[model samples]
Target: MGTTQLESVPEPKYWHLKTVLTEALDSEFSVGEILPNERDLAARFGVARATLRQALEQLELEGRLQRRRGVGTTVAPPRMGVSVGTEQHVWPGGPGDAWQSVDCTEAAPPAAVADILETGRDEPVHTVRRTRMSHGQPVAAELLYVPASSVPDLSAIDAPAGAAHARALLRELHRLELEGQDSAVELGSARADDAKELDRLPGAPVLVVTTRYVAGARTAALSVATYRADTCRLTFGDSGGVEIHHPHRHAS
Candidate 1:
């Protein structure tokens, strides 16, 4: 006779709570119906506030819940499908671009951006800040980089500097033949500055979209954007459409 051993598996509490909350949302809660306060929910679940919040945050990110600062957490509608890979080789501000310019400054970009731009570490590049909105809610933040050489005609004495210069830089980019563009998306935590612009808490889950604009033999511009992954579903279609995804938590 032989004895067999069965090993027990461990699961995180927050993950478990997310599953339970998801079921409750499906069967018990209606869209826009406010849930119990965090303290009450935590007490009901016999977990710490942080743990309860972790589950709620995940649900919010999956577009299953929405949380307001003074208001309360409620069931959220389906996520919005924002285009990503539809027309690959075009400037962002061309059409159907929801981004609005904030301001522009000539400063050294982050080291990672400088590497992609292939510019000298100390060289000043035009950094244009922009924000994207959807359904009247702030959804994304972006930084566009353009080197001095890319737009030689952009004068040191441009009529206006901030957003005007930013728009001018984008307009000049149109003059150059867009040879190609490269972009990627990855999971990331929001930085403090971006969090403020995106109206999210610091270290919130985000989808970082990095793009490089190519002209002739040089990198004309680079765009680094952070999107609210919980509310946005990156889509790429000539005719944009919406789709809903329900994420399930299951054991391996």
Candidate 2:
């Protein structure tokens, strides 16, 4: 597309520029490709630097672009499809699971978790920390909480703290038959610790997935997973894949 001056229109100039830029991105840019500098883009679009910046910011928010720490703004790939439905119901560390164990500790879970697990508010549980990676980048962090009642046979001598302990806890958990699991997803902000692990600035948007595992008619364990909102698109059912088309872009 040539440098066509956008005529007066009802929509804001930045919004129109965003549309034009979207077309350019689709036609000319490749994934992970750095975009032209702001000054050059403004001149080419016949819009002010302020308008160009506003459009760029909106695109970033929409997951069309990413501003890396040392790299300039780059075109982002289609959002990764994350299966979060009952069809994939299994233990957190079960075979084929993508999350890697990071650490394990014994501590009282949050009040909400305690309530769901039917444990005393002051009761300490085995909390396992894990991270999920996609395309060589961290996409999600999870904390799995298991009460003593769930894994009563686990001996203290075999399991201690840290990553090894986390594996032991997961092994003990696998011994029980999982009756079922239910999940809920919500928008959330990254806490400081999660942000550091995720390589995102504090308060960045995230998708929080809370799941409760049922075994023997009781809640056996609870998991809270936080995924990068910009990089993930949640999928349900047993389809194994999803393709969603938008007029501006196609999301997978």
Candidate 3:
């Protein structure tokens, strides 16, 4: 008989380590429980430190692990169930909204925002920036574009362009009857500024959520929110759940 040879397809060592650690997490680890230091874990796994870290990073992206700058890595609880949609459309700052406005400025929006707002690219808007915190950790950063015409009563006289000004813009928006709102979500990389707010390195994976608010058939406002892809689960309906199978996927 002719000799038969089979090619070996070895999975990457890091992938094996990630799978083992994941099983350990399910069977042995508890949420918020700290894992052993990296050096020890690497030695125990018979892998290099860098290989071990690669596994940990993927685990963190799955929301199965949490690592802080100074604190060691620990098991992360389930990602927060951030309600992005419901049977009834709700405006930002509506009841139970998690966003906490930080500041506002009247400025021209970027090209993307201007396009959706159907306004002149150079036209000014109330750029309200807000942050979303979950379980005491910042999980998302949002930039809301409110056209000046949408809030005619909002004047330069309305509190200086700071936290109060931001709040006022949202308050004015709520007064108008919101006819409808639409949204889309996609994978993206965090910009440098957004990365800072989300406590991640630049180019970190993020879930970009774009929304448009309509009033009386005109687009009144737009929102571009970036959620930490590793730690946030945006729930629009039955689609809410931790991303398990593709946990290793990252933004290009």
lDDT of 3 at 163: 84
Q: In the order shown, what is each candidate's alpha-carbon RMSD?
A: 5.3, 6.9, 5.9
> What's model 3's overall lDDT?
0.85
Give the Cα-based TM-score of candidate 2 against the true structure: 0.87
lDDT of 2 by residue, 36-77 (tens): 899999999899999999999999878788888888998877
Q: Once superposed on the true structure, which residue ranges of model 3 sit more than 4 Å away at CA?
A: 1-8, 156-160, 238-252
- Higher-scoring candidate on TM-score, 1 or 3: 3
lDDT (0 to 1) per candidate: 0.82, 0.87, 0.85
Candidate 1, residue 22: the lDDT equals 90
**Candidate 1 worst ten-residue window by lDDT:** 243-252
Ranking by TM-score: 2, 3, 1
lDDT of 1 by residue, 1-252 (tens): 999898887888999999998987777766667898889899998999999999998888787887867778977755767666666678857776778988889989888888888998889998889988866678889999999888888885465877777787788778889988877889999999988888889999999988888997889999998998777778776676666554332223
Scored by TM-score, the top model is: 2
Q: Which residue pairs clash in candidate 2?
A: none
